[model samples]
Target: MTKKGGSKHLKRLAAPAFWPILKKEYRWVTKPSPGPHPLGRCIPLLILVRDMLKLAENAREAKRIIFDGEVLVDSKVRRNFKLPVGLMDVVSIPRIDVHVRIIPHTIKYLWYVGVPKEEVNLKLVRIENKSLIKGNRLQLNLHDGRNILISREESQKYKTLDGLLIEIPSQKIVQHIPLEVNKLAIVMDGRNAGRIGRIIEIQEKPGMSRRKFLVTLEEASGHRFQTILEYVMVIGDDKPIIKVSEGT
Candidate 1:
């Protein structure tokens, strides 16, 4: 008989570079089960607990902790150890009072930044796309597989790449930050990944050029550079609504 489904195992060498695991020391690593985020952009909950958070000594311990309903993703209990935890997702362990939000890193593809107790329920999600849906409502597709419905009139206020501050679980939109000049933004990918700065200028081209829309960003250090609009995520208007850096 042929294999029925995808492989349950992932070789360490084949794991994502952002995963902080020994490549050669181990033959196989836990493969993230299909979830909201894609395999390349998210980390398995088991690996996150055991390796990144250092809350568990081994896979067994991590599984135990997760099975006990001690782990909460987005303010809800998540028992699946293979659950994918991706960007802007909150992981909380009430017992240990641990809370962290995954964000883009300059070196690693992703990194976890501590979240304050008060802000644990808040999350920032980018508007990947939007379209008209049933009832003539506009549906906003967020980066993390979430969809928000709004009235057609409200749709005019939002655009792709805009950031929405939402309440987890409830998912109520608290604020919307547009991607415009003078707005604070972060590079989500490319060579300048994880760099946060203010948008200074936007150059939109008409042709099929690879760089169709380039945005110039000025960092706090007074350095300015241009990157594709696809790589830029508006974080705030002046300063970031939340702490995105370790120092901040």
Candidate 2:
């Protein structure tokens, strides 16, 4: 008889290119469990602990560490070894005092950047979409699987693609960064993925669709390029609130 569910295993060769794993060295790889992010855009917790962070010598060791509640994602203990960690998610190993935030990369699709202890509880999430809900509340859907409900009047201040700096665990909004000219933004995808710059101009199309709009960004090196509004994420106003690049 054939199985009705998806396969539990993932082949090494079928893994994403951005994953820092050897395809030929191993035949099978750990498949990320269904989570906030899709398989192609996330790193499995087992792979993260064993391979990327080198915290464990092998899969068995990694599973032991994760099962012991030593690993925390977004300030909460995540016991699942196959938990999917995606962009802007914070991973912490309190036993060793290690903390890292997943961010966009120029070469690799996503990468982890070391963050200070004070920033461990803070996270930035992009507003993917929003809608009206019961009790005159507006629900904001973030890039992650989190949903924030607010008064409809207050929701008017926020727009899609805007970034919200929130305190994890509590999930309190500390600040809102709007996407507009002169704001610091980062390209999440396309040819300019991971490029950080200032938005110089916003070219809006005649239609009402915001996705068709174009944003021109000027890098610090004086290079400028145009990308779709969908690919741009506003990170800050004058400067980034957290460490985004390495060696900063």
- Using all chains and alpha carbons, the TM-scores for the candidates as numbered come to 0.95, 0.95
| Model 2 Cα lDDT, one tens digit per residue, 1-248 | 97888989899999999999989997998899998999888999998999889999999999999999999999999999999999889999999999999988999878999999999999989999998987989999999899998897897799998999999988899999988899999888788989999999999878657966988999988999999988888889778988777844
Of candidate 2, the 10-residue stretch with the lowest lDDT total is: 239-248
The lDDT for every candidate, in the order shown, is: 0.91, 0.91
Model 2: CA > 4 A from native:
1-5
- Measured over all alpha carbons after superposition, the RMSD of each candidate to the real structure, in angstroms, is 1.7, 1.4
Clashing pairs in 1: none
List residue ranges in candidate 1 displaced over 4 A.
Answer: 1-5, 208-212
Error of 1 at 102 (Å): 0.4
lDDT of 2: 0.91
